[model samples]
Target chain A: MDATPVPETTATPDTECHTTHGYISDKARYLARLKRIEGQARGIHRMVDEEQYCIDILTQISALTSALRNVGLGLLDDHLKHCVVDAAQLGGEDAEAKIKEASDAIARLVRS
Target chain B: MDATPVPETTATPDTECHTTHGYISDKARYLARLKRIEGQARGIHRMVDEEQYCIDILTQISALTSALRNVGLGLLDDHLKHCVVDAAQLGGEDAEAKIKEASDAIARLVRS
Candidate 1:
């Protein structure tokens, strides 16, 4: 066998696989959501400090979770639209790997 | 001052900051959700390949995003319940760092 190792990574993103999904496009929106989440977290901390009722704290937690969820959904949308489709178009190990990787990410997220 | 730097990281998790939240507790449930998400993604892929109507594809996309959002919510719940609370109790740089880290995570998730 030849001594040279096979090339695994391409020199540039192949076609639609720019790798950067919609991050640039959605940056402002995402940052705003995170700022809101941060405030929510801090507010929850205050509630606990003041010994607020349990149910009230839980309700706030629920809202915080919902906000975070919306953010995740936005990112996932971008990943599917750009990364997955681009990789799929390439139709090789990269394509297969992206598909599997996406599913694995979902699994990890679920269990996180 | 001695050449050695300050001991930034604790030898073990300080008090409640076990670093793990509800992942272990809800592992099975998360996996089930991911499996459903994977199916949803694949179904959407098939619809696109078969040239389904635009609205139908959009609906699937929305559903897939929502499924992913739910996973994020579950994880965030666990983090707040365990990791965040644990860190807050410690009441020091470590506590501050964890709180910041969680917010940063939310930011990153938004921009992902």
Candidate 2:
């Protein structure tokens, strides 16, 4: 009797899950981080409204920026490792496009 | 000499150089930081090209995010302190616009 399990297909699907293929596990973590960041942003708004000291407000804003950027980096990493790598392994037009897309994304981030 | 050097006019101008009034001192720091962040971003690109381990790439990206965000926060803080506060003190449509602009910026960051 045949006992070997069938290998999952590596064919890259053109679907919505492309960038999120391997990031599902980290979804909760990402969401939680975003919520905290949102709260931090609101805190900054309050500081501004209250006319708090400039230095104090700046400090909080700095922290909020750190939090948001961290999340972005996390997502970018996930997309690269799972989606881009997977597509590359398939080795075709899709691979080329994926790599180029990632490069462009990086360029945009660097510019910002 | 007058006991107090003539107080620079708080009158917000309709001309350029509004947001940068208080941030000039930090210009060098910001430039250095942006250069480092740019290098880090390029490094990520190299890692992907080399097909490095996913975890390693993620770690580096995470660090880069922190660095970039810190810079952004610094700039935002400066803008709020120098530009927004000054405008608010003057109290007019300009102040309202500045505050609204900052709020919109916060919202964008949170969404990101």
Against the true structure, whose lDDT is highest? 2
Model 2 error, position B21 (Å): 3.7
Q: Report the C-alpha lDDT of model 1 over A1-112, residue by residue, as the tens digit.
A: 3222221221223322445444446666655555555455455444444433333433454555555556556656777777778778877888876676566555544443
- Which pairs of residues clash in candidate 1, taking residues 3 or more apart in a chain or in different chains? none
- Give candidate 1's error at residue B19 in angstroms: 32
Per-residue CA lDDT of candidate 2, range A7-111, in tens? 222223452234435555666665455445435544544444444443344445455555546655676778788878888888788788667666755654554
Interface RMSD of candidate 1?
15.9
- Fraction of native contacts (fnat) of each candidate: 0.00, 0.03
lDDT of 1 at B74: 68
* Model 1 docking category: incorrect
What docking tier does model 2 reach? incorrect
| Candidate 2 TM-score, C-alpha based | 0.47
- Per-prediction DockQ, in order? 0.04, 0.05
